[model samples]
Target chain A: MMTSPDSTGTVPVTALTGLSAFPLTPLKDGQLDQTAFIGLVQRLVAAGVDSITVLGSTGSYMYLDRAERERVIRLAVQHAAGIPVLAGVGAMRTEHVLAHIDDARAAGAAGVLLAPVGYQRLDDDEVFELFRAATGRSELPVVVYDNPSTTHFTFSNQLYGRIAQLPGIISIKIPGVPADPEKARAHVAAIRAVLPEHVGIGVSGDAFGAAGLIAGCDTWFTAVGGTIPVPMLGITRAVQAGEPAKAQALSEDLQPLWELIGQCGSLRVSAAIAERQGLAAPDCLPLPVQGLKPDQRAQLALMLDRLGLASL
Target chain B: MMTSPDSTGTVPVTALTGLSAFPLTPLKDGQLDQTAFIGLVQRLVAAGVDSITVLGSTGSYMYLDRAERERVIRLAVQHAAGIPVLAGVGAMRTEHVLAHIDDARAAGAAGVLLAPVGYQRLDDDEVFELFRAATGRSELPVVVYDNPSTTHFTFSNQLYGRIAQLPGIISIKIPGVPADPEKARAHVAAIRAVLPEHVGIGVSGDAFGAAGLIAGCDTWFTAVGGTIPVPMLGITRAVQAGEPAKAQALSEDLQPLWELIGQCGSLRVSAAIAERQGLAAPDCLPLPVQGLKPDQRAQLALMLDRLGLASL
Candidate 1:
């Protein structure tokens, strides 16, 4: 639920209070698999996920040229069928990110997600200005993504406090590196205490959804949830329904997949899972974004079957 | 000591058996410090450096736009005169790198240095294909840059074997992360053994230059040497003349500078050092590519004095 753009020209979003999915950008023969991508989004919508995010790390936003990125955002916003579609607007330069934000707003994106990604390592001031520059210009809600796994830059709690003061920031994706149950919950709760009541604090660890949900993560900023929506929903719902055992069991079932995802981070792993599960085309990703190796694919297949989600 | 490009498009040259300077790209009011950049090259040449490398990490190539990058390459090549000017051609896309290669060749660059710097995490095949796409088309000799600190992608010995088989590749810059003298030496020797006899193995640790020289580094690929070249020559000459005491003294003098460089990384530190040393304008760099903090700069100034390099 989006309340439209604010007076300051930023999108004012409804409180994101449930599971959200970030779908992989499927490709065919090095071209985006638009049909498969649309189908994947449809699945998430049918599963009643809160929102669908596009152009995340799994989307291979870095690998594609600017034209391709603009096209993806346009297509995602068009096909999302009124479900709020958040577009990742990260780039190497501040101007580049601003350009993407312009495209996102034009393409009717509900909001934009940003991660501090570039060639140079930024200090606190640089990183802050990066967010401010983008948020200050965009007419969409800004979700500050803190995925140090891919960006290789960590935003301390203190840094996040400073970032929260930016005018257009509607949400912050808390990093979930130490995704253990206790650690993950403690981390989420600590950040939740600091964020404004109106702003959302989402959990990024797909495997640790139960813990995060139990600990009051407003949204599950997730990868697997985007591809296979049912199980992610099950885990979140079980926790929300006050059934800790059910939530833990659903989370436990996702452990095997999480183990694979842990190796090279979520994007690479989620891209493979989506492709194998027929949610995306066979050649759904370009070079440098290869699927899981044969043995790993087999492991994934077996895990999916054991969890009764092979078909989904 | 460099030979011109061969008929086969491979850069040919005399063995690089001495120090090579890699100067930072100076900035003034968000513009290239043309006067300072040309002056930096003149100083390197005047100090009798064996070769010069432009657009390295110290050059902040990643932070600048393509137009800015092309200008730097053109300026460096024009001013380097007879000395070999190796241009960094790393970019997020293969086509972009390919375009830089063409510019490097057209600009009269003696060679091209490359790093695996796309946003995606590269496997062996992706890295190989990245090089092949670049080297397969470039007319200049290729120098493989293996700085995991910036790129976050390390080149293993096995991967280097595959990379070595490429035609235009004539040199490899061994990583200096674990900059311990013995470990660095052992690492360089291992790579050197794998490379063709004519193909040089260079060391990139600016602080550990004499140590690398003593350890059999044919080329001291350095950042500071590109600015204050005389001291680098002194250290290398001492090592070559079998004067370990003299070499050790020089290395010890550089230790303080290296300590500061190690804290944030050479790119940021070198950018500050070059600016403070009056090689570039004060406001050349925009956001993100900042100089060292106050205390670090003080430490650097003291170290430069103790090393008798303060005047430079």
Candidate 2:
């Protein structure tokens, strides 16, 4: 899976390609549910995800404290077996992000994801300087995370070009590609045209994974893959095996679940899925983020049954 | 300014009315410039403001760590010189927010401002529950801060009605009133209709402050007023004396400054103003938030001079 390094001689940028599962940091009794968390991580490892990313939006990284985040990073690295662990180190302040990066490096994380998390609306230059300071602070490979859904900061292609020029930036995790096949290819291609050859462009938003991959996204940073990795891996492997039709059909089969995820955020629905499958405690999500209503849970159960994902 | 008790007997809800200035937390060499911050507090007190609100978005509260926030809270209270100090205790997690409420209470703050600061977009129910937990945690009066520019979580009128039902919510700090006078009055009236009589409606966005005050808003939550309070107090006094024209004229005289604020955001503009006034050291803003470009600073300086605000 190694490729020749283009700029940052140390990091194999191609390692960022393929399925990177972002697992949730489940909690029990107002504390980190280590057993459940490890189980989730082990599932990703067993399903042979290309990389395991902890403390992402799916992981409720913002809700957890420093010590809790450190624990998640350590546990993820410890139980990931041989899978490369990428930890999210985003915080409201750049200094805190640097501290998280240090912790991730100390905990043996293969890379770190940095999002321009905002309270005050951030301008293009501020976001660029944040990445500049972050890349300067650590040697670990960096992924420029642009999730406007959570961070509320959008990245322009020009800004992406500016950031990718910095050393150690191995990937750019875009929010998603366009839904249509041709538009999605054009969108990813436009971004790819700006980025260096060594930096990979990964796609998020679970439902867009197959289209993004078939359109030439280097990786699919899947949220549901953390809890239900089998289907996600099926789509990923199908795309890798040059079976675009199979990948599209597999993705279409999960439309009901994606519809539910669209109704409720992926974070809550993923927690509900894990809980329904007996993979985590009933209330695995952090407080102020109750998973789902009873009716919603019932609907999710029926949807899973219809999708034949009830047993998975 | 004291008034009879409401549901929360201990908090003086009426004290939240009139002009409440939100000051910047200027930093020096990566540490809080306590002397500069105290001077800002003293300015508000000497200007005879109704209350001084510290640790707001203008204060860069989200960018600070717990220890820094504690220091700012303590220093603000210590130097407010008996002026009621309202501290922002908003965090991403309810538990962390509760802990901040504890800190604000311990620091002798007169009230606490809560905003649903979101990384994941919070639903109305979650925001309501957050306030319920916060009010249950402390006896201080609470101001529901609804600044969508920073928090990215908009509070609907329905959500405001729901949160106002909670005890200790003395005021709702709305983003702004409409620009048109008649529309502004109707806007405030609509919100007031949903709120309890005891709960006041405050307005933010410096440009809209005078319009809001003239339209029956109980308080003007101002960013520019924090750095330069004389003109702000003039506007407030004129409105109180039933001279809406004078207040409108005063607000219009500073259109240049408001335009700057609108362009660069209040935080960066306020920092630049503080730095220019020699109240705070150069480069007062924290890392990754460089105050302003040289051209913007030049424009701000000219605006201050044209408005005859440079001497103040």
Candidate 3:
């Protein structure tokens, strides 16, 4: 049902399923902390995430320059240790997206993720044409990143169906699913009905990832998992091992972090968690993206400790 | 109430009042069409616009790299001919925004526009910190650009009040006012009540420019005005000369254009108008941002002709 774009052994669409960790490209005084970033990558690889996606929203892709993005892409691939690396190649212009895609491919990325990073509020036609251009230009399998909170462009189911038909679109990273079980299943079903069988449904929004996976999403493109992949992998393995309750229980244990993420966004919360755990440099997020204040970080630390995750 | 940052004789806050036209940085084969951009600046000067703000949403600022943005800023200031060139200095990172401000100031721009450009859904504190950093880093008077339709970060009036207290914030560029005259007045008044007396209220969203002016907004930060300054000037001057009826009438004559703009975004419509009027290269907008289709262009041309705007 799916075809490889090249013989470089790029990660097949089937491999796109399961937990894909999105790491923070932590910064040190406005410069990429390469050692810290590599540590994050090695952590993901050691934890055995299904894929390593850099330059995602959690990765602060748009904040970095092209050279920095290329460095990230290259570093991610270099350290991934045979784990498939996907790069987020989104920019406001299609040309930049294509260039980023080329960078990803050159860096040996298994796939590239594209969000309709917009400043000019794009329409359906413009978005479709962007994917058409990217898929047409590169052989790397593409992942459609639908992040309305960040990109501010909502994709209708019809639009998703249209873009899914593009030659190399291997997955759609949806925002989230409903909290209620039946409703979540219906939501996933609505999207699944439109997508080709081989095209995977990867869910974002860390809080709802377990629900999404239990409802039939193939992957959890997660923010928290990028920093602490164990609990997330527990949920994913539980789901894969046909224990939905176990997966939900694993997810429920991290409810406080999810609540904090709901209060502060997932990016900042994840950064706080990483900094608290000594995984990244202090004050790791890129500016003007301030991480949690001292009090908030303390609260997060306490929550993590209570959840038995402070040592992670 | 306002003190000049220095004797650079930068455009004062008072001068920031009235129509500040936002011109498109039309591209030719993925590069800045410098000549076309200068022509746009010269046209605005000849039409006597109060200020020329380049690299706003219409200028595709986010799509451009640092060198390209610097070029645009330099060219705009060089060609604006004393019309108080204001450059939009918004980027996702505070450092980049500061860098852009430095570039704008070095390029001899009178002021810079700051939008809370976000990828992580920034909070009020983060947005405030960004403005604080920008204003603190440079003496360039800043305009708070609140175009949520593009930036996706809505500024609460309280946030406006907080940011306005910062030194060197000259104006607040609001998206639009309410349609009903009384409601529009009330809306503007509500914002005015929060802003410092030195900070002006500039309205964007071209269709509502006339009403915004009549409702006591100081400037119409417009897209269509950049392409066809005559009628926009007519409306602005009428408002300035205390002829609200005339301003409303002139705006009414362009209703069809506004309707089309509502259908196709103002950026694409403005690009089409520039191309139609032989002002810019064919298909002038940046890649992925397609210009109007042939049929849409034809309809636009007919409307321009019908409104006596064809030869401007």
Please tell me which predicted candidate would have the highest TM-score against the true structure.
Answer: 2
CAPRI-style grade of the A/B interface in model 3: medium
Native contacts recovered, each model: 0.33, 0.74, 0.81
Distance (Å) between predicted and true CA of A205, model 2?
A: 0.4
**Poorest 10 consecutive residues by lDDT, candidate 2 chain B:** B2-11
lDDT of each: 0.76, 0.88, 0.88
Tens digits of per-residue lDDT for model 2, B1-312: 334332211223344778999999999988889999999989888888888888998898888888899898888877777777889998988888999998887777788898888887788888899999999897788899999888778888989998999988899999998898999999999999999888899999999999999999989999888999889989988998999999999899888888898899888888898999999999898777788999999999888898899998
- TM of each candidate vs. truth: 0.88, 0.96, 0.94
**What residue pairs are clashing in model 2?**
none
Report the interface RMSD that candidate 3 achieves against the true structure, in angstroms. 1.0
Give me candidate 1's TM-score against the actual structure. Answer: 0.88
Model 1: colliding residue pairs:
A27-A284, B3-B13, B27-B284, B28-B284, B29-B283
Candidate 3 residue A39 C-alpha distance from true site, Å: 1.3
How good is the docking of model 1, by CAPRI class?
acceptable
On DockQ, the leading prediction is 3
lDDT of 1 by residue, A1-312 (tens): 347553322243555667878888888876778888888888887898878888887677776667888888777766666677888888876767888999888777778899998567788888998888887885577898988767888898878878887877878887653547677667777786777777888878777677777776777888877788888888878877889789888788678778877775677677777877777777566664456777877877788788787777
In what order do the candidates fall by TM-score, top score first? Answer: 2, 3, 1
What tens digits encode model 3's per-residue C-alpha lDDT throughout B111-184? 88989988888889989999999999777788999988887788999999999999888899999999999999
